[model samples]
Target chain A: MQPESLEAPTNRPIYSPVIVNNKSAHHLFICEGYPSREFQIFYSSVDDSKKTLLLVSESDSTIDHDSILVTHSELTAKLTQLLGEMPLSTTIYVLGSEAFIWDVHSVATQAGMVAEQIKMFAPVSGQRRLFCTHCYHITEDVTHSPAVCSGCQRNLLVRDHFSRLHAAYVGVQIDAEDPDDLPLPQELI
Target chain B: MSTDQIKVRVAAVAQVAPMIREFTLTAVTGSLYPFSPGSHVVVEMPGEQKIYRNAYSLLSDSHDASAYRIAVRLQDNSRGGSVFMHQQVKEGDELLISPPANLFIPQWNAQKHILLAAGVGITPFMSYLPEMQRRQADFELHYLFRSKQTGAYQLELAEQLGQRFFSYDSDQAQRCNISELLADRPLGTHIYICGPEGLIKDVQSVAEQLGWPDSVIHFEEFAAPKPGKPFTVELKSTGKTVQVGESESLLEALEEAEVAVPNLCRGGVCGQCATPVAEGEIEHRDNYLSVDEKARQDCVMPCVSRAHSDRLVLDI
Candidate 1:
């Protein structure tokens, strides 16, 4: 019997499809993910064909047969190059996990991109990260069962409540009332 | 010598509008205190009876450190502050004032600045125009007032700002449509509104409905405080409870209890009086906190915010 986590697949793979909008952005930057059908629909809607797409995924395959970069260093270099060359009129769309997207966002903002200029989308992958509400410690890639908060040294069950400001699932004390009735081990977060 | 206090002589006093009066304060000895574009000074007006401390934004050019200019709009029901300034305060009289502090500042990184002002609310925006024109930044000013004769800086704005300035007089039945003003704004455009509570609330709500995020929308609300239900504040360290009257602010109540707290603008525009809440619910009345910060329910500016609960536990 596999252990059970607080959350399981809700028929929709969350970490797969990051963002879904046909706003026709000037630049589309994709990280490692494989919802190729949705990606095709998104990129097709955009009219910018000349140097508008940059795939920073480690995977060999890309959606539109455009530009590709594998390594993190290469991604950084390309981001810097693109941000420097482009004017403030450019609209950027970013797709990746919580941590990965924020990393790209930090770089973009440091390069003088207004928050309004960029749109970030979280993937629908099963990879779940939990953030402790108490000590505010973020536990990354917790796949199975309630985990002890590394921040405040308390056992926490990942709550369904997601904070857009914190960019992670909120985790509260699992054994608040009765310590003996600890949360049962769970999987598939 | 008090480090925070600056001695200044009132250089000139002139009626800028119907209810508005401009007071020019030059330093008594050394040059006037240096301040940013959107800075305000707390004036200590010592009348024959008591001293009334009121904060007024500096309307003069930030580069001009020799003098500081502020406009005071006399309130009919004022608590002796504006009335004293208008009727009693004389030019060449030396006065003590707190050094300038900036709670409202411009977005330097913005591609365009949309400024909305109402009557005397145009004071802060006046400080920004010189810097904006110096940088050649794209900007527009929308001024709303009672009438042409009652609006401050009408002739000066027309002469200096050319077509960049727009005005709407209520007496003339003209209105600055917030929706139309904020519509079709360019990306990276930051909107700043300074005026009455109604203007701030209306413009902000309209901007939000138009899909503008809180980051791009900025406002400074110096809305006068209103009386609320009496409440009790318990000091976390001393366990002392201070009874706040319906007519008194939490800051006033705390002071009456001899619990010292930092304060500048009693109007709640400044964030100096923001104190952390150890426990209990807070009815935030200040414009300092953002919508998300208010939702957090962790901090409250006692200068304006009253207690919704019977008792509030302040970290003080």
Candidate 2:
């Protein structure tokens, strides 16, 4: 039987086309929770006219002559404008918390950009929201090792299975094999 | 278990547009199977050399069993199927067809639905209209065609959809601004489009530009697949090798060699003819497999996909 369940004909399901070492990127748009050493190094080489950076924590504050600090709403609008008419070979670089990176990516894709044309480096990590594959529960922003599913109310061990399409990591029952026993605590994304 | 074949007689034929004829088929038996909207059936018609199986959307109401209706436009480059339906088929002729199967079902979570169609691609959308109206779902149908006279179902659509129907003629050399149509739309707005490949591409490209996720954008392309190079298939179980000609699909070649493969749409759709590949690269000409699946090279839709390598080892 034909089991090639391709949902969209032209659109790829996975987030890819990530910036590679050898590939050339024509335009670059950077979004960050705050400026970092990585940004300083990346900015040192790129021409000012070719890059636009949006820093999201500061309100009505222009931190650097080269960058603008805007809130989340302002960032959304600015990202759309920058991405709408972006020519071919445009690659966007995202840095910040897990939520900030995924949220901006969500917006970028909505505006018709593919993952291959974008890159992400989440530095402000530990913001975890894992969706349970078994119960379909989203354990939102649990900054702990043993996460609990909000829907099914079960102790879950979030796996590294990340679906870029859903922008959420998958969580499975911690006591699947050894029922009534809990595993040792471990760090989670 | 054997798949039962139903016999139906062409009760009526009418020219709905230039070079396009709509045929109504009534079941020879007591009753026909009821189908939901957005469903299609494989029509078996005698062609030049072989039995031509083409999937056609049912234009009649989903609840109707008295008869099933389908429209076929004579393609300039006549495939034996369309050419046969256009020229040889007459009223009162008995024909065989399979029961209906659906691939393009409506989404339940969408706040609104947008249906776009072009040319004879409007057949599937015709089936969606009744169900959408029955569900009382908010929908707008935008249709593009050559002209008022050439566009099938224009007057009927205008009469039925008072203000919801929009039409653009291709003669004016002005096409719908796909970007404008996609921009500034409400959240959770889902769109379904069917038409020529170019228009379909425009819609998908613009939808992506507007940040419309693939979840909200849907399309159905009915164009006959382009012919490809000939290749050989090595069936692992039977130890048989079948030579697939340039014009012959792997599925067709396998059928000719007395190997049975389940297929519904025969179009690179329905995923009914996807066969696993043990070795050799594939010329994946199907829209059914995901990018990951295509990259893995573990499977190929034999209905449309062929082997890029001279010989392919199939799991069968």
Best by DockQ: 1
- Fnat of the models, one by one? 0.05, 0.00
Encode model 2's per-residue lDDT on B106-145: one tens digit a residue: 7754557888988887888888888888888888999888
DockQ-based CAPRI category assigned to the predicted complex of candidate 2 = incorrect
Clashes of each: 13, 11
For B144-171, candidate 1 gives per-residue lDDT tens digits of 9986445899779978998898989998
- Candidate 1's docking class is incorrect
Q: Measured against the native two-chain assembly using Cα atoms, what DockQ does each of the candidate structures obtain, in the order listed?
A: 0.07, 0.05
Candidates' C-alpha lDDT: 0.75, 0.75
